[model samples]
Target: MTTKISSVGLLSPGDMGHSVGKVLVHNGMPVHTCLAGRSERSAQLASAAGLTVNASFEELVQQVDLFLSIVPPARATGVAQQIADAVKTTGTTLIYLDCNAISPETTREVGRIVEASGVTFIDGGIIGAPPKVDGAVPRIYVSGPDADQATILNNHGLDVRPIGDVIGHASGVKMCYAALTKGLTALGTELMVAAEAMGLTGSLREEFELSQSAMLEHLEKSVPGMPPKAYRWVGEMEEIAKTFDDVGLTPKMLLGAADMYTLVGQTPLANETPETRTRGKTLQDVVEILNEALPKGK
Candidate 1:
C-alpha cells in the first residue's frame, strides 16, 4: 500500500523548519507550521514562506497525515510527548517522524511512547544540511517500523536513503559522525584557544604556516558554522561521549572536543561574525576576541 503523505506539520518552525517546509511546498506538499511563539512576526514568516499557520498543535495534529519533527534531541521527547498527549487517541493513521539527533536508547524510548498511543512511529535521521534555497540537495536518512514513510518525504526533493530495518542504525551513524567531525572541530578550537593562551599560539600558527595543517581548512569551514550550531552540538557531543564512555571505548578525545565546542558555544556570535562579515575564518579575529575576554595577569 502506498503511504500517502500530503500534509506535514512542523513544530518549532525556524531556520531548519522553514527550510524543510519550503522544500515540501516546492514539491507539492501542503505544510502547516508553527513558530517559536504565536508572535505576529512568526505568523508573517509562515505566511511569507507559503505555509499555513496553525493556531494550535491540535490543529496541526488533526489535519496532517505525517508529522515531521526536526527539533533538538533533549527536547525531542518533550515534543513527542506533547503530541502524543493530545492526539495519540485520535485513531488517525499518523506517522510520527523523528529526525532529531538522539541516541538509539532515547529513540527506542520515544518509540515506546508513540507505539503505546497506537501511532505509527518512524525513526528518521537527517544527514545533510537543510533543504536548498536554490537547488542544493540535502540528504535525509530514515528507518524504523514504517521507515518507508521516508519516501513520503522525498516529495520534498531530498536525497532520501534508508539505512536498514530499524531506527537506531540511522541515528547511530548520524551521532557518531557528528561526534567525529563536530568533535574534531571542537577539539581543534579548544586546543587552538589553549595554545594561544600559553603563547604557543605563534608556534601553532607557524606549524600551520610551515606544514599547512588542514586545521586551517577546518577553521575556514568549521569556526563560522560551529558558533551558531554550538548550542545544539554540545548536548549531542555529550551524548556521543557518554555513549562511548559507557562501553569504555576511550572517549578522552571526544569529551575534550565537547568541552571546546561548549566553550565557543558560550557566546552565540550573531551572523557567525558581525566584525568582519566577509572574512572566511575567525583565526586572528577570534584570538583577539578570546584574549580580550581573558584577564591580563594570567
Candidate 2:
C-alpha cells in the first residue's frame, strides 16, 4: 500500500513554486518551505501562498511526507544534495519530486543523490504555466518506479500524471517540448535584434505582417514576456542543449539560445520580477533595448 501524504514541503518558493504551494494549501494540504537565507522576494511569495516557513531543511524534512524541488535547472543538483543531507540527518523518509527543467541525465544524477538517503525519488516535469485560481492548470508529469506515489497530488488540485515507470521519461518529454517552444523564442529574439541593429525594424515588421503574421504574432507575445524569466531560462536552454547532444543531435542551436538568454539577462529589464515588469512594452521595445545593451562591437 502507498503511504498517505499528509503534508508537503516545497524548496525555495519562487513564482511557480509559490503558485503550486497556494493550490495545495487551498485544497486542504498543509504546505511548508524553508526560507532560511532565501531572498526577501521568496519569503514574501511563500507568505502570500500560505506556506509555513521552517527554520531549516532538517526541520522541513521531518515535518512533511512529500518534498518538491522546483528550482532552476542549474541549482537542481545542489538542492537535491542538500535535501538528501537533511533527510539523512533527520532520519526522515519522504517522497522527493524533482520538477525542474533539466535533462534526463541530470535527473538520474539527482535521483541517485536523493535515493542514496533511502527516500523514494519521483522524477517530475511541469508543463504549462503556474496553476491559476480559475485559468488553465499546469500538468506535472511524473515517471520512475515510484511515479504512482505522486498521484496523491491529484487529490489536492494538481494534475499529476504518471507517464511511465522509467526515471528519465518525464524529463525527456520536457526537454523535447521546451526545445520547440523556447527554441523558437530564441530564434525570434535573434532576428528581431538583428533587424533593430540594421535599422530595418519597420520594414521587417511590414514583411512579417504580409507573409508571416502568425509567427510574428507569437514573437510579439513571447519576446516581451521573456526578459523577466530569461535568467532561469539560460540554464534551461543549456540543459536542453545537453539533452539534444546526448541523443547524437548537434546541440549548437540551443547552446546559441543559452547565449541569447545570457545576453538578455545582462539587460536592465531582466532585473524585473514577473509581478513588477512593465506591462505595455512591445516586441519592438524589447528588441531596441536588447540592441542598445549589446556589448562592444558585434
Candidate 3:
C-alpha cells in the first residue's frame, strides 16, 4: 500500500526546519508547526514559510499525516518521547520521522518510543544544507521497516531516498559523514587559532594555499559558518564519538572534536545567528575572531 502524505507537521521552525517547510508548502503540501514553546525567531520563520501554527503538540498530532522531527541532535530522543505520548493518548496512527543527526543506537531508541504506540517510525538523516527556494533540495535518507513510506515525499521538492529496511542505516550514514566533514572543520579551527596565537596566521595560510589548497578552500567556506552552530554540533560530535566506539574504533578523535565545538560555542561569534552573519564573511574574519576569543589561560 502506498502512503500519501497530504500534510506535514514540522517541529520548531528554525533555519533548516522553516526552509524544509517552505519546500513542502511550495509543492502544495499543507504544513503546520507547533509554536507552544518555541522562540520568537521561530515564530517569525514559521510565518514567513507560511506554516500554520498549532497551539500545542496535542493539536499537531491530530492535524497532520506525518510529523518531521528536525531539531538538534541532543533533543531528538525527548521529542520522540513527547510525540509517542501524544500518539498513545490519542490513538492516532500517524507517521513520525526522526530527521536529526543521531547515532544508530539513538535512532533505534527513538524508534522504540513511537513504534510502541502503533505509530509508523521512520529513521531519517538529512544531508546537505536546507533547501533553497528554486534551488537544490537536500537529500533526506531514510531507513527502517517503514522507510519506503517516506518515498511519498519525493517529487514534492524533497529528495527522499530509502537506504534499507533497517532502522539504523540512515543514522549510521549521517554519523560517519558528519564525523569527517565537521571533524575537519574542528581541526581547521584548532590550527588556525593556534597560528593566530603564534603570529603565524599569514605564513600558514600561504603554506596551505601552496600545498593544501583544497583543504584551505574547505576551511574558508566551513569555519566561518561554524560558531553559531557549534552548540548544536556538540551533541552530534559526541554521537559520532559513540558511533565510532560502537564500531570498535577509538572514540578519542571525536571526543576532541566535541571539545573543540564546545569552545567555539562559548565564543562571542557563537552569539551571531545565521540571519545576522555579515554577508561575504571570510576565513580571515573567523580566524581573527577566534583568536581574540580563545581563552586567556590558553
Q: Per model, state how many residue pairs clash.
A: 0, 0, 0
Model 1: how far residue 192 lies from native, Å: 1.5
Candidate 2: where are CA atoms >4 Å away?
Answer: 296-298
TM-score for all models, in order of appearance: 0.87, 0.97, 0.96
Ranking by TM-score: 2, 3, 1
Instruction: Using TM-score, give the best candidate's number.
Output: 2
Please give the lDDT score for candidate 1: 0.70
Candidate 2 per-residue C-alpha lDDT over 174-193 given as tens digits, one digit per residue, 9 for 90 to 100: 99999889989989999989
TM-score of model number 1? 0.87
- Residue 190 miss distance in model 1 (angstroms): 0.8
Better of 1 and 2 by TM-score: 2
What lDDT would each prediction earn against the true structure? 0.70, 0.91, 0.88
**Which ranges in model 3 have alpha carbons more than 4 Å from their true place?**
278-280
Report clash pairs, candidate 3. none
Poorest lDDT segment (10 consecutive residues) of candidate 2: 273-282
